[model samples]
Target: MSIEDRKQKIIAEFSMFDDWMDKYNLLIEMGKSLPVIDPHHKTKSNLISGCQSRVWLQARYENNRVYFTANSDAVITKGIVSLLIRVFNGLPPKEIIEADTAFLDKIGLKEHLSPTRSNGLTSMIKQMKLYALAFKTKHDSDKKED
Candidate 1:
């Protein structure tokens, strides 16, 4: 589905919950559904700094799109990361850069997050976008060289 559609779905899901606790529980469940990343790959290179929990993110380019996998020691944090991955993963670099993350506010995510957690989320998003930019640059350079 398109990112816009996914955003709507997420907002709808969030709307179904009566309180923040329920929403948080749902997010935690979402985190549990994230794919397991192997222990060896959880190195400093993949580490997502600024989070209270240890979060690791990895990205790759395939068929001109970027794909990502992430993990976190905190279940809620992992769920937040999972949401981000769903929105940003497997998209072209330019698309990732241009994405309107304003939908996060509509879903009451940023407002509900703790200051530290918000910072961590921002850091993770920035890092993920940076990875996409790097891949785009490398891919373009290789094409030019060819």
Candidate 2:
């Protein structure tokens, strides 16, 4: 599905919750559904700075798409990353880099988060885009060489 489709689905899901408590519960459940990240990739290099919790994110480019695996020590953070991964995973590097993040505000996720968590979320998005940029650059270079 497209990123817009995924965002709309998440918005619909969040719309079901009348209260922040219920939304938070849903977030916890989403966190539970995140696939476990490989321990080997949980290195200092993969760690995202500025997060109150330890969040490790690893990205790989395969078949012209970028795939991400991430883990966070905090449950809410884990859920937030999982949501991002859901939108971004398996997408072309250019697509990921160009995707708009307004859906986050539309889902009321940014406003609901604490200041630190919000910063962490921003950092996570930045890091993911940076990885996409790197992959896009490499991919473009490879094409030129071909």
lDDT of each: 0.83, 0.87
Model 2: how far is 52 from its true place, Å? 0.3
lDDT tens per residue, model 2, 1-146: 98889889999998898888898888878888776679999999999998888999999899999999999999988988998898999999988999988787766686634456436888888899999999999989999999
Q: Could you tell me which residue pairs clash in candidate 2? A: none
TM-score of 1: 0.91
**Which runs of model 2 end up more than 4 angstroms from their true locations?**
112-118
What TM-score, to 2 decimals, does candidate 2 have?
0.93
Candidate 1 ranges with C-alpha deviation above 4 Å: 112-118
Q: How big is the positional error of residue 14 in model 2, measured in Å on the Cα after superposition? A: 0.6
